[model samples]
Target: MNWRNFLAPYAQVVEELKVKLKGMRSQFEYESSHSPIEFVTARVKPVSSIKEKMKRKNIHMDNIEELQDIAGVRVVCQFVDDIYDIVDRLKSRNDFEVIEERDYINHKKESGYRSYHLIISYPVETIHGERKIIAEIQIRTLAMNFWATNEHSLNYKYEGRMPEKVRTRLKRAAEAAFKLDEEMAKVKDEIQEAQRIFKTNKESDD
Candidate 1:
């Protein structure tokens, strides 16, 4: 199969979603409000990883469309509440239909993975017509993102068969991260106020 041709639409979905999400952040900045979206990033899964996942999941090449994460968008926010706020916004968007949702924050994985996952069906205009594809969006706080990033790296290093001790340590780290987020939430209002003041001062200085 033509991998590039097949992945083209997924790439378009990632780019379009990134632009729209970043635009949301821009809008919050313009209003001088705390943006639930601290940042937006997106990517189309690579051919190698796609093939690996398909083989692992027993998915046929003909059913490649069944893989929801071929296109991924990650929105990192400041606090846990911000994650839910972003999820609500994403659910309300008309550009894409939210087909599934997994609240990993409230129901974390056994490996201590915590993120709110949304599977969305997005339509991309092609030369022939519009084609709908499934994409995954992950919303998580900064602490969650940091811990998850490290856990991902460790998982890659261990090839998913992590040592028992390493797994235990990771779980502990995840808890610590969540605790940090909780503490930050307690002072969220103060933090936002200070940030707004700093931003205002910076703008005046320029």
Candidate 2:
């Protein structure tokens, strides 16, 4: 089948999934921000080209109706614990079926990275009919995402094979980013505690 013919239907499904996920994320942010939990931002990306390449390789994208992970959503959180909390809430939704999950935090990547990924099947009713589409959800802290982005860019520039010096530099950067994440987490807790104390003092004075 031609690329256009193969992708048209899937593209529509992906767009619908993006809209739904965005709406869900907005609701989540609103509800969580009021509490001690920090709000997170969601990003959606379509992997149609990657799926097409898999087809060329004769890899049967699981559930042809739901070509695995053609659409992706990334939820970036502030703290490590928040990542798990958000994933739990998302998994609890009846509209989504978690197909697979990977926790890269506890087990860091060789490149010294961490993130959580969830491959989920989300049902969307389109003009064609009800279609279950795969959406990969990635959850990570801001620091982790920053490190990953830099490493990804460098890897792409070097076509996955970089000079030893550049590789070492990236490794150093990753370590620095890890430390930065820890420090930021500590600062965040301190600020939250101060805010609570201020609120308590104001209430007492009143």
RMSD of each: 0.8, 4.9
Cα lDDT for residue 113, candidate 2? 77
**lDDT of candidate 2 over 117-141, digit per residue (tens):** 9888767666677877666778888
lDDT of 2: 0.69
What TM-score fits each model? 0.98, 0.73
Model 1, runs deviating above 4 Å? none
* Per-residue accuracy of model 1 over 1-206 as CA lDDT, tens digit each: 99999899999999999999999999999985688888888999999989989998999988988899999999999999999988898899899899999999999998888999999999999997999989999999999999999998998899889999999999999999989999999999999999999988999999
Model 2 clash pairs are: none
lDDT of each: 0.93, 0.69
Clashes of each: 0, 0
